[model samples]
Target chain A: MKIIVLVKYVPDIEAGYQFNSARRLDRGGDGLLNQLDEYPLEQARRLAEQFGAEVVALTLGPDEAEEAVRRALQMGADSGVHVCDAAVEGSDALATALILAAAIRRLGGADLILCGAGSADATTSLIPVQLAARLQIPALTGAASLTVQDGAVEIRRDLDAWSLQLAAPLPALVSVNDKTGEPAYPSAKAVMLARKKPVESLDLADIGVDPAAVGAGGAKVEVASITPAPARAGGQILDSESDDVVAAFVALLQANALI
Target chain B: MSDILTLLDDPAREAERLAFAGAIGRPVGVRLAGGPELAARPGTVAAALATLAVERDAAAVLLPQGLFGAEVAALLALRLGAAAITDVVAIDPDLTATKPIMAGTAFSRARVTGGLAIFTVQPGLEAPPLAEPAEVVELAPPAAAAGEDRVAVLGLTPRAASGGRPDLLSAEIIVSAGRGTGGDLGPVEQLADALGAAVGASRAAVDAGWVDPSLQVGQTGKTVSPRLYVAAGISGAIQHQAGMRGAGLIVAVNEDPEAPIFEIADLGIVGDLGEVLPAAAAAVRAL
Candidate 1:
């Protein structure tokens, strides 16, 4: 059995960020594997161990994004693939999914494709479904728990009001959320050995993607404008440390008619 | 300004979409109500919508912003070669959309350069200026949707209602807790109950198994905008702020004075949640 987990390199949200003149994220900053992507990587590693599956980690980004694939290898992936090209920059979710679909096909597909519920930077949660659509496969996304057996993949999803149990045949896509489980930390030995894993790099042409169909040229949507979110002026902080504090808080709620 | 179509899984959520479509100022030629059967099958729904959009000359397709709505919109847009954006908070007459990005730390105004535009309207918009009632159309699954046949639903169980608490999305008041709760939500629940508010949790609390993942609020979790949002024990990371910063009023209680949550809070109280939350509940009950 073979499993491919899609991972991404995102700017550390805590480290902060800035937008370029084109209103794109400045990727020349400190970056790491998106926290959410770890969940699927961990799940893929577990499945490889259980079923003797070949686990491959895949990512799409600029030259530096190979770091994300290397990180995945350290976490137990057998190998890594990086789809890196200048033309892939500034591509929206639609184009990104299209390129990923092409890359997956180029790799000869898999028994199961796994990924995070969403990328931390985009947080649109669009790629998994879009990729599934492009691939013409069933997508069981936002899975809290997932298991593969009997040539099918099943997952448990906890929605706002329902807990759904969904299943799809092999060669399907599954996007797992943080609830799946905590990712295991790579050992120091694994980190050193990860450098030995073969990392294949592909550009848009290699993936059969037209340069004009992606990046700024193929972007279906354009950022009209961007601005810092208007800051909220914080109110007074009551530090009385007494009963009066509770009274004050309640009174303020009443004054605002929030209760 | 051109033809628009809307697909809502729940009729109960129609008002918000109506208001959103009204904001776009276009004729909604059709409103597809995604009942149980259709809502359960997004691939089928997307295939049907793909045909419907072309047939109706729909320039835009709107749906409720949530997990289901996002799925259908993405699939439909891909099939139609259209542009899709999710969790949109506002739309201008010219089709420019305003949405939070980078975990609500910033806002992006974007527009589809060409072709149809698909959007999922977030909840909590005002009622439509004039209700434009359109015929509710039910579509039969298209043959192309047969591709979805590979998937099956094994079971679905509705979560037991939480003590009649309002849903976190639609609740007017929400009391959320975080790491400081020490995995004990009793105080948070009490405060929420006293105020008739919904219960919420930050990622820390959810990660620590103090609360259900469904109740989590953050960039990766559910976004909420209640009239009153109370954060207790949460230090307020940027991800957490992205989910709740839109609330009309924010009251934060944390032991740390330098917690990032206090920076955006409308009301900041420096104290322990265990003592402050219970006391606040008692005070609210007396009211």
Candidate 2:
């Protein structure tokens, strides 16, 4: 079996991020592999090891995106694919999905595709399903736990009240939540080995995607304007030197009739 | 032609979506997917929405916001060649939209300039009911997307959570635990049960493996806006606040007086949540 893990190089969410004139993220700042994407990468590696599947990490972004794929290779992926094009910048979720689906098709398909539930920066949680849509595949997203066996994939999805066990045949897409567990860090040897691994870069034309249909120019939606959120206005704060603070808190809830 | 076609998957958001339509004063046609049972696939939902939007000649389509809903809205927008925006907080009569982006650090006001637009409205936006009922159109779902049959549900079991966790999106009050819980959520769950509130957890607690990641309320987790958000042992980081700042009222209990959670909380109590949550739960039970 062969597996493709969708990874993204996102702006360092911990850093204070700012937007560019285009009202999109100013990726010029410090960037790193999206934290959530790590789960998919690690999980795919585990699955690959179990089934002796070839794991490929695919990333979409500008030049810096190759770093995401490199990290995946260090963590045990066999190869890497990066969809890097000037036209992909500022692309909405749909456009990103189109590009990825095109790239996936170009790769001749795979038995399974894994991705994080959502990105740490955009946090839109859109691309996973959209990619599945474009690929004409079934997507089991937000799966808390997943396993593969007998050409079938089973996932346990937490629906707040119930845990649902869903099974999907091979060649399906599954978006994994963080509960898939912590990602494995690469050893020095693994990191060095990743340097010699194969990395392929493709542009819009290479993937047969129309240049006019993506990027900021082709984006379907436009941000008319953006403004920074206001500073948090400090609410009433009371010290807890005594238990009276609890009484005050209770009283406040009472005053608001929330109690 | 109707002005808006809002997709509702959960009945809990019916009144809210209707009120939003009324607030915007736009004609709204509804496509309510089965509740609790989200359509097996987002592609099916997208197909249904595309058919509805085209059949009704709606200038815009609305979706109740969530992970899956936003994805379908985007796909439908692409399929229909329309504008699609997610995390929409408000839409004015003039068709202007308000949505948060960049992890809630920024707000954008946009108006779809094209012939058709799709917007995903955030939850908890409600107003008085419309004078007339919203238009409900029956939809025959299109054929499933290719390979959709590959995905099958094998079983469902009630997740054995101690609190019988309420649906966070619909819960009126949310009792959330943070790192201050020291990895134990018993008191938090007890407090939530006592208040009949859903139990939510900060990313710290979830990452620490103390709580399920699904219960995480943060920029990277589920966004929510409830009538009351009781944050226990939470330091009120910006990411955490990004998800819950819209709550009608916020109460924070933490040992540190300088915790950021207090800055946005309507009421603040500086103490151990292990003690405060239990006491507060007991008080609520008494009340």
Candidate 3:
């Protein structure tokens, strides 16, 4: 069996993000792979190891995005493909999906495709479904757990109050959530070996992509501006001098119906 | 714009549509998602879509998180020859979006395909851009069958209690207790009451059962992007930051000057939460 995992490079959340003078995210010098993408990467690696299948990690970004592919290789992926082009930056979720769909098709497709339910930065959980739409495949989002056997996939999804088990045929797309557990850390040996693994780099033209179809120029929505959220004015506090602060606070709470 | 129509349930829907119009640089249309009762009705899905199609000629639609279903978004995107981008945190001038990847480790820029686009914006990322009222056309609800196989809202229960406080995820202002609270949430709750804020617990505090799991804020727990997030008695952890980093204003109260929370905080109170919260609460009330 063959599997493909999609990975993305994102801003490191811990570092905090700021707009540059140009009003774009500063990128904080270096961007890390979207944290959620790890789940799909790990899931793909496990499936490959279990079924003795080939797993490929694919990413779309600038040349710098190879770091993400390298990290995936270090995590035990068989190989990787990097779709890098200057135009790829500033692509919206749809354009990105098209680029990925094109690349996956060019690679002769796969038996299964996996993605993180959503990335941390944008939190747009739409890719897996959108990609599946583009590829004309069945897609499931927010799978908490999954098992594959006999060319079928069974999944457990959490729907706020209840757990649902769903079954789908192969060649499907599944977006995994954190219910799968943390992705294993790469071993030092794997990191060392990753350097020796094969990673193929491809450009937009090489994938038969129209540069106009996948970048800022192609996006249908635009952001007019962004400003700091309006400050939340602190609510009134009662007398502070004594244990009655609690009582006063409670009184205020009652007045506001918060208690 | 003749090509775009907005779908909403009420007058406030105008705010959301205007916000999108301001962002998208296009004329906007408004379609009521229906009345309060009709909006949440299980059979409203098809009606909502049909209204979108008829009144607005809405090729595609954008919804905020929690208001729409992923399945519906996908179906609508396909139906309109559009792409769906859920959880959009930020959009660039050219309409490219920067969304979180991994859990919150990085961000990627993406664009939607086809002529139409559907997106669900992440809450609190930006204020809805307000515009002058656009024409709002009310259409009859579509047939009920359009909602079949769509998500069903079983019930609307109040968020779980977190030591008598609202769910941290839904809290507008959170007063979080960490190890610095010394296992006592009394002071934190006292301060929270004073400020009309919800009480939240760090993973450490929750694991210790000093607070409920519903109050836990971190990678393993609820992610909150409140307008104001106040962290007290807790040292910042990368995991904890993941849940609250999107908060608009982060206020940290800690005795230790080197606590990591200070790095991301807009205001740092260099004292114990026990001592500082009471004082801050008093100050706020006096004003």
**Which stretch of 10 consecutive residues in model 3 chain A shows the poorest summed lDDT?**
A234-243
Candidate 3 segments exceeding 4 Å error: A11-29, A159-162, A223-259, B1-51, B59-62, B66-75, B82-164, B167-172, B177-196, B201-228, B233-250, B264-287
- Model 1 chain B: lowest-lDDT 10 consecutive positions: B29-38
Residue-level lDDT tens digits of model 3 in A135-200: 776665566677889987667655433455655677887778765756899999999999999989
- Which one wins by TM-score: 2 or 3? 2
Docking quality (DockQ) for each candidate:
0.69, 0.51, 0.10
- Candidates sorted by lDDT, best first: 1, 2, 3
RMSD of 1: 2.2
Docking class of 1: medium
Write down the lDDT that model 2 would get.
0.79
Best by DockQ: 1
lDDT of 3 by residue, B55-89 (tens): 64554455545323444565565445566666567
What TM-score, over all chains together, does every model reach? 0.94, 0.89, 0.67
Cα deviation at A47, candidate 2, in Å, is 1.0
Q: Each prediction's Cα lDDT score?
A: 0.84, 0.79, 0.65
Q: Candidates 1 and 3: which is better by lDDT? A: 1
| Candidate 2 displacement at residue B119 in angstroms | 2.1
